[model samples]
Target: MSGETPLRVAFIGCGNIATRQHGPAFQTIPGVTIVAGCDLLPERAQAFTARFGGRPYTDLTTMLAAEQPDIVVVCTREDQHVEPTLAALEAGAHVLCEKIMAHTLAGGQAMLMAARRTSRLLGINYNYRFFPPLVTLKRLLTEGALGEIAFLSVTAHAFCFHHALDLLRWLGGEVVALTGQVSVAADPQVHYPVRCPDFVYVPSRAASVVVRFASGALGTLTATRYEHLTTRLLRLEVAGARGRLVVDGLTLDDIVGRLTRWPEGQEIPTGAGPERGFALSFQQADRAFVARVRGAETPAATGEDGYAVLLLERALVLAQTTGRTIALPSLTPVAEVGR
Candidate 1:
């Protein structure tokens, strides 16, 4: 919007994530304002207002009606996302929803359907896509510095299944079919040392997923919750026909021992800066939504993308449960969730 006024934004679900991540991130954008926030807990809402600079409310309906914000940030729990999101979209506001889109496929579908019916933009917060270093990796792969990505493998730690899924979709083309192996730990209370607030841990103790992309590339995404290995959890290896991107330690492997520079534009990270690197993607995601509202940049992962992630998550879970290979976007029908 070529310096047009800031878009008025309101947030729902003023919990740990809303107070910590999204609120601060939204403030960093040029044409966005975190005008108000709503939560069931008044104290939490007040805390969010104090920390994030927003008017507090205890009810979403009243907040939406009174504020009439241009954008609504839905930071509710994975299972609680649909209602508030649908209400926001139905009220003629664009939405940016948190990850794991929903707890069930039907829940995701409901949000997707509402956004489609309302014709309002519905963005999913796939924050890892906004990581500066990962952005550098994406540019390299897209520019063919890594020629024809062939095999992708992720040896990641706990609570980032969605990140791995989105990375696969970004680097490899559409997934055609997949088979996976999940190893559940003997103890039910096992926990990983993952520190991010936005990541909702999947119940599986350990997972190994094999995905086949339509572009004919085969990849594996694995997560291990072994106690000692959770701190450094984001190791990735994207081997292409030419070069490769190995992000465990942020190095490029192309048969040569190492490639230092990020092919001219690697060092200079664009968009939001590093002060919020812990939640870098959320800041960038907020920026993207505001840009779209102002007719500036196009958003990548929309509600459909969120639905796809939920489907992927569900497919993996179903795979683990039924001991069978699952096709993309296909699962046994079930009763609607959170109805």
Candidate 2:
């Protein structure tokens, strides 16, 4: 800990996510200490601690109890997310979890309920907005640079639909109703795991959804998993009344640093800056979480936001399975006011 009592950060699952994204990023965030790391396996946590300079443990409860971290990052599989997140939040730690939040709406809401019960911050890793181009796009929309958005078209192949859904919600607004296709796998009993290794992997391996935003603008999202494709594939077309914005790919240089994609005549917003790494976006996320802890700003993505994304994900699957246009549901039984 350094500089006026740093926030102590603990990692619940120090696998690839903790090793790659959250670990290094947390180490660099000002006033944040990489206090402890845990994994179901000792070797994984040990490796994280060895590089990231944290104490390592095998069990989450023991680590949280002994170290009393200020923030817990749940980098476990989606199915494994709720337990550790709930445990840490109940222990009064702010939590940041990898997205698609959870596999089901109830699972996501359970995590939200834990945060609500404890009044701790629960944030999601919806890091797409951290891209400088999209940041600028968000700014343009906010400042009325694009006027009222007309429609959006997106094609993405991600491990899950959460990020794509977040982009749609971010570019447009709340979804009213949607219809499309969702499937776990082309082969029954062969739904492949993308990156997740530890837990039972259950996610739509392919998805296509047509979103009707509450703003009355419409959008289409297509997502699928290419188990063999080495490169990321993403494209966004945002059409507004005044002008149009299109974004391609999701990498540091490919997405944010590539400035040539800026709308025909206008420069990127004067103050829009690149958030260096897609990994670096985790740092930006930590900065926001720390800011929230300091009462200076809000966390990047709230529990409710993550819950809403899950709703859209589940709804999309439901729409395809049931073959009906499904109206979106409230995040909870009723909205959690002022969340």
Candidate 3:
């Protein structure tokens, strides 16, 4: 086979996440070039450019005008995601935006609109779904190995409520009715910059949400603030008519009765190191975004997918506040997005 055409790529933010996850992983993906980078802080941008071999800019418009990259990676803060993403999409650049898609509902909607207005593919960097174990789970569901999914129980213990919300969509189809609550209970185990009542908040920080899927299946989502736990733990259980699948880290075991079944796990242990399982997940996500940018295939975390998760979260929040189950609304699933 012949070599593929190189794709010019720009880094829009030079923050810690951009440095750690995006930068290292982008290098491994083929057909990508770090042609330009932009940051509000010139020093940080310059430092990143020096390390990654890209021209640095303090503003996005300047970078877009100069580089005209095929893809723009938005790794800015949660509050700053929409504007730069919209600007990049409008400039005809495909975007891979960081998670927590946007800070507010309106901001999320605006970003959605911008992607629709332009034909450029927009994707959210939802790294968790790219996990090898999770990927296996999705395939199992699609292959009918899991039978009809009756219920999904997810236990997310950290600042990753979005992942839990996104998983609901990933596994249980669209949500029709949701009732939830976010509570504040004192715990000394976790530390974060964003503060809530009793250092806890609802939906995002710590919450119990019950999602009723359109197919009549039910899912229960719960996230808690553990006082003594330092490591992140995600426990997802999908119980169907046949059996239950429990996966933690690299091990995926199908439990029908007292025995484990099939390819039990990966060779490396789940919490072995920072460079193993989850690291591989991020690398997979980087490649997926790169593939989408190269016109190979749409990423698993498409703009429509991200917006759907946001809409579900918004509905869950309203349900928590109103003391009633909120019904899902009709949404525009057009690939284009704008604000």
Backbone clashes for every candidate come to 0, 0, 14
Alpha-carbon shift of residue 14 in model 1 (angstroms): 1.2
Whole-model lDDT, model 3: 0.72
Candidate 1, 1-339: lDDT as tens digits:
537676889999999888778888888787676889899999988988888776999988899999999999999877688799889999999998887677656667788888878888888888767656566667777788767778888866556666788878776767777788667678867754332232234534778889988888898988766623324546667787665666644211111112233233233333434243355566676777677767675535777677666666667766767788888746532223223
TM-score of each: 0.84, 0.87, 0.85
Q: What stretches of model 2 exceed 4 Å from their correct place?
A: 1-5, 183-190, 194-205, 226-232, 257-277, 330-339
**Ten residues in a row with the worst lDDT in model 1?**
250-259
Sorting all predicted structures by TM-score, with the top scorer first, yields 2, 3, 1
What lDDT tens digits, residue by residue, belong to model 3 across residues 62-160?
Answer: 899889998899998776888999899999999999877777666777888887778788899887777655666776777887687799888876565
For candidate 2, write residues 122-159 as lDDT tens digits.
Answer: 98888776666677766667787667888888777645
Tell me the lDDT of model 3 at 312: 72
Candidate 3 off by > 4 Å: 185-205, 227-230, 250-277, 330-339
Please give the range of 10 consecutive residues that has the lowest summed lDDT in model 3. 251-260
Q: Find the candidate with the highest TM-score and give its number.
A: 2
